[model samples]
Target: MLVSKSAIAAVLALSCLVLVKPQVADAQAQRARGASAAAISYEEKKRQTSDIAVTIVTSGITCTCARFAEDIRDIVNDLRPDGLRVLPVLGVGGLQTLEDVLFLKGIDMGVVDEDNLRLLKKRDPALFANIEQRVHYITRLYNNEFHVVARKEFKTFEDLKGKKVSFNLKNSQTEVTADAIFGMLKIDVERLNYDNNEAMKKLREGEIAAMIVVSGAPQSALSRFRKEDGVHFLALDERSLPNHDLGAVFDNYLRARLTHEQYPALIPEGTSVPTVANRALLVAYNWPESSPRYQRLAKFVESFFDRIYQFHDGSRHPKWKEINLAADVPGWNRFKPAADWLARHKGALQSRDGRTLADLRPAFDQFVANYTASTGKKALSPRETEKLFIDFTKFLESQVTSQSTR
Candidate 1:
């Protein structure tokens, strides 16, 4: 009680110190709690790492589907910050990829031959009854030509009747299509299941009459295959078939050509080999819109469609030029996200029926030139040139408008 001024001041300071200590401690404890809550758990860390990743299971490396996947991996992956990561998984080719799509865990997408689904429906209707609901397509990617390589002596597919022919690996796309096609054509051949290399070897030795390979033109395995070995791609023109009827074959397959440019060794210059082709599909699971998976897939569709045109500019794959972003795939429902995208940006790149203006400019120019020449006009007049250019742009715009309206 008998305190000097300094003593009283010291006592006051001590009292203040005592009161502030708990406040400092409470602030430190609150900060520590906040830090603890902010720290991410391992499971959540795993999810954040995995959420951006989408695994696309495709056919063998030799198959064009894999080539397409590699293109996606090269272009889609590595987008910094906000971009998606595409992981390409190489799988057994043909319909097997379909199984992977429907059954395998962590497979976000697959590249499957469209006919594979049809074959599945045919083989077991009950098993795949709800397949259409479960699976959906992003787009019809490209066509895989059905190649029938045979010795020079075997001029037509019929000549190989009752002869040994390799149908590639059993249950492979080649075999599945070959089996269905041959059976439809009513041609009976001694069926053999061999991979492309083995089939080519046997074909060279005349052990087999022909080997069927159903894949994109200039398929990696066949591109290097020597024509000097006396084997060539047999013309699968409608006329070559028994009764000249390809109506049945056209049920699921489209008429396509193997051009000389694609396979310089297999096809002659300025000539093309006529063949039937099965369309390859980029398919995904039918994820609901409310799910996180759907958001991820939608991100993919937007990013891919946005960057798709670059793929045609000669950097990615030659097959990219063949992709028609607006092309409708028969019998397969497009993924809701992909469909919604197309609906919003209809004819975003395509002009007429899936052919883009870039794809038609050359042909259109040639037609104009030929028309002028036929009319005895040596060159397009200044007025004509301007008119043609306007018309060209107008035509593409008109197509885009027409599609968007519908």
Candidate 2:
């Protein structure tokens, strides 16, 4: 072939261009994959952070427990800077046992009832302390009265004495309150071992004269069963029960009404019966400040409180509005963070107390001033301000060393 020097040079250049194009393309693909892998790796590391992960274990699929679990799940799934993944696990047997196992297995947090949390701390202070700071009750869940459904043949709680009375579960809040109700009304019924399902079956079969149930309205085991069994929910005369304290375990118990509003069949509309309804405390183990989950969870909790009423109806119960951490249990260690945040953000938090997130607006304004003064910088954007506030709060939480219990 007749090839000139210029032609030869042109071919060499073309070949070089082709080789360079592929090298650039390969580098771009590698960078893209590296970026994707980095994002995936970050998320995986976040998931591996047991400190931020929350596992909610509950046996009952009642409105209160289920609703609370949904809230936690929403917080975890919500796309936020802090990584939080909530795992809701339904289990049988006991809360303490579940908590112990989760803690031993490196679970960061577990939501349980107040009584169970207390029992765990009482039984083993050291072991409880290890996870104590991590475990704090956020809110008091549904509280409804204890219903003693008996055959209409029995007129009063006393009239049902000496008969076989079935309780929901052993060592449960329901069972404990049942003991108090019977003792107070001077109703000496034999304590028969029967689960809620079993008790309902026995009630239908005439094996059990009366069955006691503790549950929220619109969806309670007893309320549901009473419709089928045609049983009467006997009203306890609150004045009758002696030693109303109920062995101190049920100190915060109230003379709740098994109302028709909640259970139309059991408590026909306007039919008010005296029963003790206790609140269920949604708890989680306290995590160290260094934990990633703690930071994300703290922010989620703040956001939850911000839109508190949007999700819950204030008409559910007067107590719903009065659910302030400082008010319900003034000395309660469970809601310390919530309480502190509420204090700092006074008007900003939603409550019947006329508080909202706006209360924190003043503090944030002050922060802007201080930040500007110290850094010689202009005010931060709203998003920047919020990020800074969250970081500061997390830093403060990290400084806290003691485990909380109340």
Candidate 3:
């Protein structure tokens, strides 16, 4: 066989390719085996740790942290016997932390924003059981109305147009919520990132038109601003305020009115600080069957709801009484353990599976009416109020379970 130079080169190339094929095949086979083994190990690890973790994330150093820590201590104590360890997890940053944790496996539990439930569920339906099952409505949190306390001139929302405003931080829930609230009034809010103290300094120096501050009621800033600055409370009508959807985003919030008399210095006897209510929920995922601690914790939550008023009564705002455990608010269905306990004890215990929304309306409406009548300042005596709340919590357990079964 007389071969041309090209044919000779082709033969050499083919011989080399044949020699390398075994090495390549061996490498790929080894990689495949390694991958399979790694996957098995990961799955086993997940199974081992799936039963006994209780992690929590909170907005650090903020006002809510103190109360949340106290509330969770009681919850953890109740969850004993399951060997559950409650630990603080930093860097949740905001509501997105809830979504991030849902993607992680074997974690067992953590808290999240009730408003972000839709977004979280879209990522993993199995991760979150239902709107009511996987979540619990712990308390009603309020977003204190912080007005841009000017000397006297910055009185109206329209007056602040084109002016520089102070914000707590750039991406803070405070700023985002503020933008939504102010956006409705067509005010072009230019937020400058400064700490609360610095923001106040800027306002005093006339370097900023006003500052936005938010906290629960009986806040110190309200007193300081009123006493020193003689600030005017900016009024917002529903049509003029930002975040019309706040009512929907916050399950514990009520569309209540804020009159100026609440803060003597900030608002004259007649000033109104119109703002939306904000809610902070106690959130967690499913409790593993193997963890006895989680079961105990579930029972604690039920009992705590029965007596929460003892802890929150008369210390701060009277509005705490209005926070109900059984109210059917949008997106509270993510706290699976609490929901299960509520449903099982309140509704399903009476029947085989669970009660539907259709079965719960009449009772739910009565709850609402009674809750309203009980919460007003003039409505119930202290002892009567306590008993009413106890009944209300019981009803909420039933209503939520019934709604979820449907």
Candidate 4:
């Protein structure tokens, strides 16, 4: 209780120091929280900006093209690679899909039949001049089998000469392919235009002798038909058709068979019907390499190719099994970014010698050169060569990647 003035001053100063220390600490903590919040906001903005959302135009609701598009959309969404989002739009068909990708604003890609390129060229040569250079394929999808269903009276394409036939709607894949096939064979049938259902009714009513449906095998529309309906698939004899000139309409069409296995109720057991098929292609407009759109698309390509196995695992559409990512689409070029990605990974995929894809380019080129020199025949086209190179690379990747994983 006996305190001096210096002791009293010392006690007051100590109290002041204790009170101010907590205030200063609280202020510092508040500033730290503010700085952390700002850093988090910046990161979120960067991530959103880096995300890619693209729309792919596909065929109408009933088409396998649309189903394939939806499957891709789901797979890409599931993978969620860097926020990649795929939007599949339903268009009229292949031609519309092409027009959407080419002319429509904000459209990134389309699912089109390879034959549509030829049809576009023939229909509007001026409009489609250098079209191949404008539109590029990402990958080749499944084949569309050409189905020529006829009345029992018409056994072969020749027997139905001068008879009325429906090629679905005008500018459709069936119409384009049927016209070209008929023109090539000199079989002049009175061409009629009708929807698939209407054409089916007409065929049953004897209004049309035959109808053509160009779609993937086991077409849903045709599956509804009963064997007692008296309709049969006409055999497209490749032998009857003249030798096709390279890069012609006949060139893209492959010889395919329709068997009872595919249509048990319609086709008899152990019987097969011969027909032609055209491939569907996933094509994109050639955006400039320097543009943001191109970069975004390139990201999508890498994600798609890297996870392609998911599409073929039987969970997706059955048509996915037919997809050959490296298949060649004659007369069309590949998207630069996609082609470059494939090329860069080619060596790693195929060679056990630790070489990059670029390292194997010279050997691939030499092989082509040697083959042409030895056989005295025309060499593979640039697209064909790229396809073979990719195929070989894929084979190598399977062996090497599988072993490494094990």
Best-to-worst lDDT order: 1, 4, 2, 3
lDDT of 3 by residue, 280-390 (tens): 455555456466545645654565444544545355354354444555556454344456555555542233345432233344345434544655523334444344434
The TM-score values for the models, in the order shown, are 0.75, 0.63, 0.55, 0.70
> What TM-score, to 2 decimals, does candidate 4 have?
0.70
- The lDDT of each candidate is 0.77, 0.56, 0.50, 0.75
Model 4 misplacement above 4 A: 1-51, 78-82, 238-252, 347-406
| RMSD list, candidates in order | 19.7, 16.3, 24.4, 19.9
Point out the worst 10-residue segment of candidate 1 by lDDT: 1-10
Cα misplacement distance, residue 391 of candidate 4 (Å): 22
Cand. 3 TM to true fold: 0.55
Off by over 4 Å in 1: 1-45, 79-82, 242-244, 347-406
Residue-level lDDT of model 1, residues 302-338, one tens digit each, is: 7676556546756666887678777887788889888
